[model samples]
Target: MASVVNNVVAAVANASNDEAVCGICLDALDRKRSVTLKPCNHQFHRTCALQWAESVRPDIDRPCCLCRSSVREMVGRNGRRVVRSYPFEEEELDMKRQVLEGLLNEGDSFLISLNNTRDQIRKMLKESEIERAIAEKQRQPDEYVVDIDQEGAKLEKRKHAIDNLLEYGATITALGDAATVACAISRELEALNRSNSDLASEEEDGHYAAEQSHNEDTDSDSDSGSEEEIR
Candidate 1:
């Protein structure tokens, strides 16, 4: 059994990609830089693969970073190789579970930040238009031009962050090697669904906040009228 495991591991060591890049680190794979973490024949940067194997959560299969395949060792029992993950796989799996939770939290945080920025832009649009209308009636210069510039800057920053995120997603989707990407692709489809849900939630929250603010403003106006009548 030991000999069989050694042989398989040895075979995996020789697997190399011809100028192909490691999907995780985006580094070129060659004899020096690449290694195939076996049971799944995918080549990655030695460091990248180690980091990937290290990243697997406790409950899920120890996945090859590129393919999400179980990178288990075939243990020989009675001269027959049986699939049983290595000891590290168990540890890695636990660690991976933590990371999965962290990723979900991070995604929610990102959506919150995105929604806040969208709300700011919405508010700014209303303020700018109303201010411009008031200025035109009085034949006065629009004093909020600087505010508009600041809002434009904010919009540009938001756009750049979104663009980079989209490009990263595109790169992940463009990984065409079926043996190394199919499983990951399915997870990405699920991510797309989560993204849609996030957007819907953002829209609902925005509408609710707007309504609350409008009601508060109406109450403030009524209180001011009552004070004037008292005076």
Candidate 2:
């Protein structure tokens, strides 16, 4: 085991000290035209790596062929490279949060508008009621017989207006109720998505832990076998 580790270390040291061939093109690496990737320290021709990076879709980072290390920067169409610097998941999460916040704000505004409309409807009904009462109280018995038709017409018109107002108010109230329910359902769905995501992450972590434990146990058994052979 020690010899294997030493051999791996020596290989890495030699690669770092000497100029190695480009992994992609399998040709000699030029000192000025080569790039050493981070973390992996694998060397490759700058042009060859750039071409490889550009061949893959730009939406995802490219991984090194030799060590599978992530290459966060890619050569753009205009030959400019930009660093991602942040995780894609984090960016998506931020966008979702912004959208949810906007939805909540719009919901608040809608509710406020509905409340104002209801208040205006109530105020109009109260004013109309008070006017009707005063007009009736001011009428004399002689005037009542003469203006009965006119009064009836006015009352009918007023009643129609009141009925229309009530209908409009009811429609608006129903819409508001529906909107409230929809908002609640959306909230529940968002929570369910989050719960499912968390569960999946937990399962993945448990699987990784189990795999690592198994690997360690296998290594231990191998070491025991070597010790017995030496004895």
Candidate 3:
């Protein structure tokens, strides 16, 4: 499957307002960056979609938050293919399996980094709020007032950073989900091919055994006829 997060992000960046409401974030689709999944046609705010995708486990298919359809394909309103996946040949499947493995690993690493960044941001925010509280309790000196304002600004920035990191985490999680599905499909196809091969081999062996038995029987009959004729 295609990179789920990237496709959703592209659709969001390019989308215009619609009358639909996002089921994930419960926000008006007309008020936010939105995407309508193909086939299912379920609309969601892009950020909300990302958050939902991030919450899904990477070992399974990422489904639509509303209808639970596997999020494999998506197209934009402009008829542009946002994300489309196709069945792969055996060789291509092997390659995709390998690539997805690497992608999952990288995605995991990126998510860990995002989590660390978020934690740091929250820590800074908390520390700033505490400092601001202390400043408020003291006399309203000019320097203290400046300090409070600066702390407020820092808190705002930290909160923004945390929000941004959360978005990034969602993107990474979506990518991981896409990779997981692709890998699972690749493995299943490979297993099916192997099973078919085994069945063919067994049928060939059975035919060969029948032919050998028939030949042995024919030889025995000929020998019996010769002995009877000589007697």
- Backbone clashes in each candidate structure, one number apiece? 7, 0, 0
Q: What are the models' TM-scores?
A: 0.24, 0.26, 0.28
Cα displacement (angstroms), candidate 1, residue 62, comes to: 1.1
Question: What's model 3's TM-score?
Answer: 0.28
Write model 2 residue lDDT over 20-112, tens digit each, in one string. Answer: 566676555543245566546666655556456656666876677666679655432224442222112233334334333434556445445
What local lDDT does model 1 show for residue 189? 45
Off by over 4 Å in 3: 1-18, 76-231
Model 2 alpha-carbon drift over 4 Å, by segment: 1-16, 74-231
> Candidate 1's residue-wise lDDT over 26-104, tens digit each?
4445322345556776665444454455465546767665455677632221223222122222332233333334334
CA lDDT scores, all candidates in order: 0.44, 0.46, 0.49
| Comparison by lDDT, 1 against 2, better one | 2
Answer with 1 or 3, whichever has the higher TM-score.
3
Cα lDDT tens digits, model 3, 174-228, are 4334655445535544654564565667734222111113444434322222334
Better of 1 and 3 by lDDT: 3
Worst 10 residues of 3 by lDDT: 205-214
User: How far off is residue 120 in model 2, in Å?
Assistant: 59
